[model samples]
Target: MRLVAAAVTFGAVLATLSGCGSDGPSGPVDAGGAQGRRAPGVTALPATDPTLIPDVGERLQRRIPADTGQVLVVYGEGENSPDSTAVFYMKEGPEWQRVARWAAHNGRKGWTVEHYSGDDRSPVGVFGLTDAGGVLDDPGSRLPYDQDYVAYAPTVNAVAYDHVFDYVIAIDYNRLPGTVPHNPTRPLGEDRGGGIWLHLDHGDGTSGCVSLPKGAMKFLLRTLDPAQHPVMVMGDERELRA
Candidate 1:
């Protein structure tokens, strides 16, 4: 089933790439998913410096879809269109392997830069890594949250989650209660994606979470590692996937 899915996704990416489409992420590109302003009494940035994202010589890198989540999604960096081209890669044993690479889109609101506009870009920071398998256990979805998983979708919508291949990573940029820590080993706030999280993509532009086709998301969730202290790199097209 996995192999077949991979083949289908590859073909789709190829097809879409061959014929670029401009009907993915809608609205204006706002460039800000994080609330930005620190919450009262919240003195320090959540261990995640939005200004400085270091590739710990780790595994995966994403390009194509652009949005910050408690997860990181980049789009429009290459031949991939803002909504139709994207590739999610992870660093494995020795090299950064392409777990899943396919078409994607970004926000239609084009980065609303607000708490409600739904155009806010994904946030950049260190959030708590959580095991939402049970917490997020849903008969509506089949994501292996029971395993090692950390997501940051503050709210849930059926369009994005219902898709089989979609994986949504949220950013804690927006202030909220948030989920609990899955792996207690890492520094509490430093190990996870702030309010950010990697999640599935809805055909529509996202409020904050990085959205993608279903297949790309599944591969990401299943193959992600916490020890690497995974970092989601986001910014201008030139700075992010360099």
Candidate 2:
């Protein structure tokens, strides 16, 4: 069965909080002076710390591009489980910091390293995040956004699949990058499957794409930057640890 392109909409307003604090020494300075000392209760990590992508094994971690500053990790519960978690991380200096995490769903049949057409399993490995689009208008996405209602509209189960394509980030798995998520140009051929995306969840697993909450989808659409060279690392927990 051909995979249907999922749609997603992003118009949710996000609130931001800022705090003001006085900048003065709260405690005594050490012998190295204030510049060398951390805040009273703060601890410092060495420059050579190597936990860049937490929970990811060496093999998968090495696949991440050296210049990539943003990473989305989809940790499936099991090889045959649809339930999973999606965590977003941003690179700060030499460390990777957790930004946000949300409950997510993968393919109905789970994950696979050898994904194919109609497999009902989300592909596992590192893939670039380059383009986005949906049936709705763009919501401040930093990546190239394509807004096509006709091409992105859900073809089956209209009521049940409504709003799934409101916001979508194309996962460059088997398709050409830099094109709209709905684009059908699969460089790896049709049998490998294509059109996999990170779209809004419809309370269940997808045919091949990964699904996230509406709020999470909106947040990702607005936050994932093309300049950051973002990539997604996805697989079951066990395989990710390998």
Candidate 3:
């Protein structure tokens, strides 16, 4: 069955950006300082320069390659907020440009490094965007698309699952790319976490996936070019700066 996009409006996201100034963060600072310690809040990075997208900190930023062309940054409002902002950026020449920003719903409990199945917490860190799929046909996404009933089905009622997978961009957290998104062969051994994706919002928190409005999901699918080496940087505001 062809999936139809849903009409859902999400709340707005407030960003505490530091505004235009300087280059990237100076030296390496621990994410939120020493281990286990949390930063006061989100570190406003200078997105004004365009040349410098706010640095998510040394530990996290180091994982991203300089040549990566596309990045989706998901910033949760707090350590346990169900809401967050997902911004899409494209590397143009020497700098990155903010294409679009949308509000999103993350795991109900927020984020965690030790992610496990049914954790209700999204994993924190950078991961690749390598696949796309849904109940609908291909939406011109660069990533391989997998269209199947069970592939996008929700065990719950249709109301909770409706349009949830009309569009989905697989976040390569523990699964492999170049294969179907529903492969379920998680390299992280399934227990460490898997099946994380950027999907259509259902007006509520997800089990462990990130949900954006249907329009934003469509925009992401059409814009996230696999050849550009897309990746997602995700974490809580403080954990991001930390």
Give the winner by TM-score.
2
Per-residue accuracy of model 2 over 28-123 as CA lDDT, tens digit each: 112111233232111233323444676787899999998787798887878988878776766655566555566678999999999999999999
TM-score of every model?
A: 0.42, 0.80, 0.79
Better of 1 and 2 by lDDT: 2
* Whole-model lDDT per candidate: 0.34, 0.73, 0.69
Those runs of model 2 whose alpha carbons end farther than 4 Å from true positions after fitting are 1-50
Deviation (Å) of 139 in candidate 3: 1.4
Highest lDDT scorer: 2
**26: Cα error in model 1, Å:** 24
The TM-score obtained by model 3 is 0.79
Error of 2 at 88 (Å): 0.4
Clash-forming residue pairs, model 2: 7-164, 7-165, 7-166, 8-165, 8-166, 8-167, 9-166, 9-167
The per-candidate count of clashes, in order, stands at 64, 8, 2
Best-to-worst order by lDDT is: 2, 3, 1
lDDT of 3: 0.69
